[model samples]
Target: MKRLYHWPLDPAGRLVRLALGERGEAFETLESPPWSPHPDISRLAHGAVAPAIVDLKTEPRMFACGTRAICEHLAETGDGTALLPESAADRAEARRLWAWVEAACEEVTDTLLTERVMQWVRRDRQPDSARLRRGAHALRGRLTFMNGMVEINGYLAGRQVSLADLAAAAHLSAYDYFGDVEWDAVPDLKEWYARLKSRPSFRPLLADRLKAVRPVAHYADLDF
Candidate 1:
């Protein structure tokens, strides 16, 4: 059995989940929020966090930490939908864009998503206006870039869905969960997201709900 430890809204974890879904792999999950690290995660590896996985059926109990390690491991081993493209050039492009998505959204996650969790889930204090503004500005730039990519390639990396599309979708889904995305501003990207959102792989993410905060009204609406 494969056991995945992950936080629901973490883009890395979401990406891994989407990959697993696309590959038709079944695995149980344990929620491991980064803010308050789960004790069991430390047993896997020092400083291990969500998005980690352990293959309980393996001889030595194989384990992988982080998205790059886990997702790539799945890509290499799985028999279902190919996350990486077939051709070498397309594979390289997929990987490049996959890495790019994580990098590009780092600032937005660190600022906007973090603030949302703090303000809503934790309810510790008021959110910082400066951080929210900074993240919003960064998100807008990313949306523009992604919009252009889809406009040119039909998908993030190419004609078919790849890890790049999954990666981009994961991050954007998190932002949309908190009602941060300006979908109307990016028409092409909005259409692309709608298609991805309609997929079975995306259903688990759309169903995610926090006890403290509800997702935006249109979050689970396929046609929206």
Candidate 2:
């Protein structure tokens, strides 16, 4: 069986879970908190971290350390709806958007999402008002850009679902878990999210729960 080491709220980890689910691959998860590294992570490699995967099914145990490595690996090996588009140009566009989502969400995750996790889950300190505000401000900008893309193309890169959609959904879903997303502000993006949220691959993500930090009421609501 394959084993996935991941943090429940990490967008990268969630993205991998969604990809696995999309491929109908069954794997067990071992929690690797972002604040506390899992022992097995270092065992996999010197600086390996959560969102890593180890395939014990392989003779020598195939392993990957990051989203790019793992998702691309899965896309190559899995037999199902391609995670990437077929055309060369389409593939390039999808890859570009996929990278962009991660880059663009980095600020939001580091500030807003990180502060929320620290305050609610760890309870180590009070939430940082400045960081939260910064993250929210950055997130709004990203949402507006994404809204325009989906409004014009029906998806991030094109009409068909691709890794770009998954990447965007992963980050957005994490923010939504904490009720950070202002859905009303971007109606088109909200509609697009509703469609992705209703996918079968999204079921496991909807079920995710952080014991100390519960998701928002609408986190799991497909219609929301």
For model 1, the superposed segments whose C-alpha errors exceed 4 Å read none
The lDDT of each candidate is: 0.93, 0.93
TM-score computed on alpha carbons, candidate 1: 0.98
For each of the candidates, the C-alpha root-mean-square deviation to the true structure, in angstroms, is: 0.9, 0.8
Query: What is the overall TM-score of model 2 with all chains considered together?
Result: 0.98
Model 1 lDDT tens row, 1-224: 68999999899999999998998888999998888777888988877777888998988999999989998998999688999999999999999999999999999999998998899998998999999999999999999999999999889999999999999999999999989999999999999999999889999999999899999999989998
Which ten-residue region of model 2 has the weakest summed lDDT?
A: 73-82
Scored by lDDT, model 2 comes in at 0.93
What is the Cα-based lDDT of residue 189 in candidate 2?
Answer: 97
> Per-candidate TM vs. native?
0.98, 0.98
Kindly report the root-mean-square deviation of model 2 from the true structure over all alpha carbons. Answer: 0.8
